[model samples]
Target: MDGLYEQFRIALHQVWQRRWLAMAVAWCVAFAGWVAIALLPNSYEAKAKLFVAFDNMVPTAAAASQNPQNDIMRLKQTLTSNENLTRVVRRTDLNKLVTSDAALGGVVAGLRQRIAVVAQPDSLFEITATSSFAGLSNAENARTSAAIVQQLVELVTSGQLAGDPQRTQQSLTFLDEELRRREQQLQEAEQRRMEFEQRYMGMLPGTGTVADRMAAARTELAQLEQTIVAARSAVNAMRGQLAATPATVPIPGAENAYAGTASGQLAGLEVQLSQYLGRGFTEQHPDVISLRSQIARLGPQAAQERSRGSAAGNGIPNPSHVSLRAMMSEREAQLAAAESRRAQLQADLAQLGQRDSAQPGAAAEQARLTRDYDVLRQQYDRLLADREQLRLRSDMQTQASAMVVRVVEAPRAPSGPTSPNRPLFLTIVLVLAIGAGIAAAFLKGQLQTTFPTANRLASVTGLPVLGAVGEVVGRAERTRRRQRLVWLVGSGGALAASYAALMAAEMLQRGPVA
Candidate 1:
């Protein structure tokens, strides 16, 4: 602590010795600092605030998915997009103002860092912009801020759906197209249903729906009846031929021969049948004798057939009866079937006539088709009605689009310069000057080869500083008195110089009196 005090004392003495140089340096530094502050560009800042409102009146159930806060955020992003910014730049003519001077342009570029956009906790925003200029007026700053707000309003509200006029028209156009398509499809489907109904009018599978089937059956039955008539004519022709034929006798020359032929023919039949003895004929013994007598009578015809055996190609002795009976039976069955078919045809034809008379007329069918078509047309009309209603809603919306923002509190010109903070600058400069003064005192001490204490001198030179007196007390006392006088004079001179500079600056700004 002692050594430090001694060092300080020595530094103070050195500085006092070079007081003129020290003062010159201090004045130079002060002037330089003042010049730097004067050359700095002047700057001004402007700020504005806006309050957002959500004015939709629809009920929550109708728009359950909507979030008003999210909508506001979306709007905020749109306001800041490049597209909106470009519009803002053009409308405010910012480029013109910013580029008019190089310094202003630099200030504009720096504004990106200085400008602030803040959203308050409760859905409000504060927008601020800063501009720097050499000699800007307060009115100019106010005008710039007002213009920026106007441009922002335009950029934000021009295309917010509520302001667009074309949306309603587009919706109407789309609805018209869809309505047309539905109408066409309905017409085609109706036409196809009518054609199908006409082609299959009465040929349906159910018995109750068989009008066409009955007609077809009647026609088929008529054709078969004609065929039966042809068959009956053939039967009559055969009967006529049978009636014109005469019976032949095997023994025609003598009556006795005839009778003997009959008896002999019967006996031959009896003798041929006797080849099989009846095991159960005991009770019918006389009946068997009578059958023998009858067979003996037809034996002559058997003998006649035997005489003509060479002409009989089939070995069966009596094929005439079997072939004639089979042909007769087949003709009878065919005739019966034809008659049955005719009866069935008559019944079916009667049923068809009844059904035809019972069915509704073409007028009624057409009315039914028209009724169905009207129903579909009504449905389509209802849909169109709904769409038209929505279109009216859209049209109304277009007429009442969202409002653009207007200023609640317009910007006003500030009274004071925002830049060149004088109090802060003065404080900083005074502190720096004191530090420089201390440095000068220390540097002077080092350059003068001065020793702070006797011990230091002895230690440095390896010699005793005999009777080293501190600061040469008598000289110091005189210097102290001299220093008091010098400080008074020097401070007075600095005050005069500063007052002169201030007067010059003020004069330059005010100009000479008229």
Candidate 2:
């Protein structure tokens, strides 16, 4: 510890002996540092405060429950977007100053680097822009910063700016069109479902398992059996009535009456021909031609039958037999139709039984169809609900009843440059210059092998020094030393003068301080 202290003392003494050289080195370093600082452009910063209030005229439960932090973040991103930056550039002199496309891009990129957005307490946000250009005047720097902030404010306030209210409206319109298209799709789906139900009828997979379908089919079959029984009873009753009536009823002019009706038959044929013509069938159609020929043949036959009836002088046979035959024919047709319906019901019942026997296959198919129908139905319903919610949101937006951005503090021009902090920079440069000077002095001392102190001499020679010699200066030597001091002083003054001139030139170029 004592040795370290002694070494430190010796180093201090050596530094003191060459103090002028140290001072000169320090001065040169400090001058260079100050000149570099002067050459640096001034940076001016402008700041604005924004109080983001989530104000809405008609606040919904959803909107009110939203996180304001997320909205604030989104707002920050919007302000920093390239589109907003381009607007800021256009509003200032940057647009004209930038020449080519690449230069403009570089300018925009540099501007983005100078901007900062910070969220403070109490829902307030701060936007700061720093403007600095090579050889820029203090007033120009301040003006640029102010312009950038002003353009940012305009972008935030104007809804027509890109990715703001215009985007919101476009999204709403797109959703509206999508909703309409979905509605059309839903209507078409419903139509298809109704048609399918009509075509399949009872066979449709409706609200039950296969067992339920089987039970329904059995019930339908029972009902059809009862209808068949009723129809058979009616047929039997009609047969009994025919059986009770005589097969032939005596009528004085029955035969002649039947023969005389030929004229009415010919009139019926003419009516049939007219009906075919009205049905859009041409006369060349097989059915139309056949009807015409039948009418032509019937006309002559009717005339002959009428003449024979007139010559015989007999009234037409009793019309009761004709009436009985027509009644029997109608009953037989009804019985046949009823039997056919019963057979169809029986066939449907058999199909249901077969499907029940093949339970796995039938059940899988039924499940698949049911699942598909249910999925589509659910999707349709969900889309309907979403459309309703979208409509409410779109209405809210259209009415300007949603959260909005409002500026609490407007931007103003800065009074002075915020950067290059000349005092602090100069202080740091002075410290570093002193340190460098000390290092250079120690380095110069180390290069010489001669002992700088008595302790170093003793340590190297292993001998105790009792005395030290002091050189006495001659007259000529003294004059030479004095002349050398004058030369150094003159050189220092010249350096000082040059530094001052450089400072003056820089100050003149920067213009008067604002």
Q: Tell me the TM-score of each prediction against the true structure.
A: 0.41, 0.52
Candidate 2 lDDT, 267-363, residue by residue in tens: 4555566677667889799987887787677768766855776423433332554676677788778768867876776776677667557664655
TM-score of structure candidate 2: 0.52
Cα error, candidate 2, residue 282 (Å): 99
Q: Candidate 1: where are CA atoms >4 Å away? A: 60-115, 133-409, 452-455, 468-514
lDDT winner = 2
Misplaced by over 4 Å in model 2 are 1-9, 16-28, 31-39, 59-62, 65-71, 81-83, 100-106, 134-138, 157-160, 169-394, 400-408, 486-513
**Alpha-carbon deviation at 62 in model 2, angstroms:** 4.3
Cα shift from native, residue 230, model 2 (Å): 46
lDDT of 1 by residue, 1-52 (tens): 9879877777677777666556656666666666676666545556666666
Report the CA-based lDDT of candidate 2 relative to the real structure. 0.69
